[model samples]
Target: MDSSPHKLYHVHGFDSRQFLEHYFSDKSDMAFGDDVLKFPIEKLRQVFAVGHINGDILIDLSIGSLIHHLYSASEFFKNIIVLKANNRCIMELKRWVDERTGAFYWGHTSTLLQEKEENSDQCQDQEAKVRSAIQHVVKYDLEKENMTDPLVLPPADCVISVWLLEVISKDQDDYIRYLRKISRLLKPGGHLMMIGALDITYYLVGKDKFQGFTYDENFVRKVLAGEGFIIDYCNVKERTAVSDLTDYKATIFIAAHKEK
Candidate 1:
């Protein structure tokens, strides 16, 4: 395993299957599922269920091949555009999107969503709704001026990003630049819903260890305001599970909108 998970993910590349099974499997890592999955999933259901974030188009810039959170998004948005930094992750997403053989099972996530909505039988339909809502799965490079240059997408009405910017950014400056790129995708007054870990330095993906930019809740609000966003809602949940895969103190979710 490389010292930098980014090198493994963005440079050399690791098995997307391992990445998924390591975290999303029914018997996956406990710490990851609790703080990373369950906490964020709850926050998503809350924010999306409220009518504060209505939109026609939603863009997702998240890590790996996970679409679990999009289950809530599918209920509100008409079209969902997914942008990935690497082709491997992009292909992983497409495989699940197409329901191809060997795809990672998101049944655990579907079950969680079902439990939240109190509809035990809707697990099967959650996958179908996400598949239908995803209009495109496109590859992008954050280093580029236009991450999706030459394939200009329509500005989004809202952007949902989780567990991505922190992993890809090497420092505070990189975070700001990457945020700017993401903000560009939003139309003026569009929303940005972000989720990340507080004070997390690194996280394990299979055998690989990826470094993350550590920041507190204060910085999250500050950065969003600096980028011309108005804070609408914020939720911070303390860590409840124990795992050596990652060392995060808390999970934070912020819903903000770009100033018109």
Candidate 2:
């Protein structure tokens, strides 16, 4: 079976490498992480299975085409509350949405107005461009270091974070805190399906050393258990190829829900 996500007319060999490279760059360490590739299949299946997802809001951290796919597939697409936490990621993703006219909300770790005032004309235009692409988009400023404060986010039925937990917290406690905060963004009894890497590294804003977090399946399950999320389905696996042939193993995907 061909695993490439974007197959035209069911024809394979589309060479998605260029598309991935242009956006992901040599930072395959961060870009093509396990969640980036696997969640398309895993998340989609989970979302589809929950046939009642119509009218549910979805917040996506680190924007990608997954929302677009979900949008196209479900009657619930219009009800999704989309979000991209990172600026650079949102910028690139906004470009994609521009071409496709995806509807979403772009949440920023920083203020959008300040960025417009400080950045160059090209930069300002980019933000405007993203706004033009979507029928509805809202930008919110959140202090990246602190996720504890009550945030004014759109009410969501389900919150999905693909490849996001690794970037927010370094250790188990902080990771759990961040997840709890994000989950709070959703209404009670909502679901959450997240895909995180087993061992992954990345730099925090102003932090020099790119830190890595490693969590086995049990560890993650325990964390979620405390946060009112019960693991419904999980699959752990490894992948063998990035750009430079330097491979990595990931814990793969997990789909869970906030127990009613």
Candidate 3:
């Protein structure tokens, strides 16, 4: 495990601009376009549209560098708390949240989401809604017994963890442990949404290589059920040959509710 303070899973000098350009933007150099980016976003939209997802509090257990998943979620949940594993990720996200100079532009993502959800292409209004709905952006440690220690937050009504477990977990055992730890933050019968890379070992960000835990859809279902969650939705998108950016074979998206 890389326990170094500065080299957390998603915080090794990660370039937010480079990340956005590589994955979300329509740059010619990007290997894939809307096909890859739209998969998780659209699946998440479907999960939230089911009408049971609304609540007073939603906790984002994401790595903090990506904000694409928050567009639809912000409208349904009254309060959103973003949790980060490292300072660098926290700072990058804060820049966008505060609309500081040099913040990575997310208007493209906002516009896409708006068009899909409302059938309108307006941008700034949706972005403003996300910024206003975010109540807290705080640090979290998956290794800790209480993921958000020292801050006694109430159990959340919904928790969304996107592309987090596979990247941070060192192995299958670690993945299950981390899942249980975070799931504890949810109230019984509360919902959990997770996105992960399937059958991959590593990913590239800028010039740095990040490790990932290799697993498939069956592993995801088994682990969530073991942690007292009832799986409701599970979908996987096979990777297109257009991108050599990572070793992942597929992207998995899941939504489940904790069993009381």
Report, for every candidate in turn, its global Cα lDDT versus the true structure.
0.83, 0.49, 0.78
Model 2 per-residue lDDT tens digits across residues 145-168: 433224456666766676556645
How many clashes does each candidate structure show, in the order listed?
A: 1, 0, 0
For model 1, how does the per-residue alpha-carbon lDDT over 19-87 read when each residue is reduced to its tens digit?
877766787344468766677778888988788787889999988888988888888899999988788
Candidate 1: regions farther than 4 A off: 1-12, 28-30, 118-124
TM-score of each: 0.93, 0.62, 0.90
Off by over 4 Å in 2: 1-35, 63-75, 100-151, 202-209, 242-248
Residue pairs with clashing backbones, model 1: 5-210
Error of 2 at 16 (Å): 17
How many steric clashes does model 2 contain? 0
lDDT of 3 by residue, 189-227 (tens): 999998887987766666666777889999889888888
RMSD of 1: 1.9
RMSD in order of candidates: 1.9, 13.8, 3.3
**What's the CA error at residue 254 for candidate 1, in Å?**
0.6
Better of 1 and 3 by lDDT: 1
- Flag the better candidate by TM-score, 1 or 2: 1
Candidate 3, residue 256: the lDDT equals 93
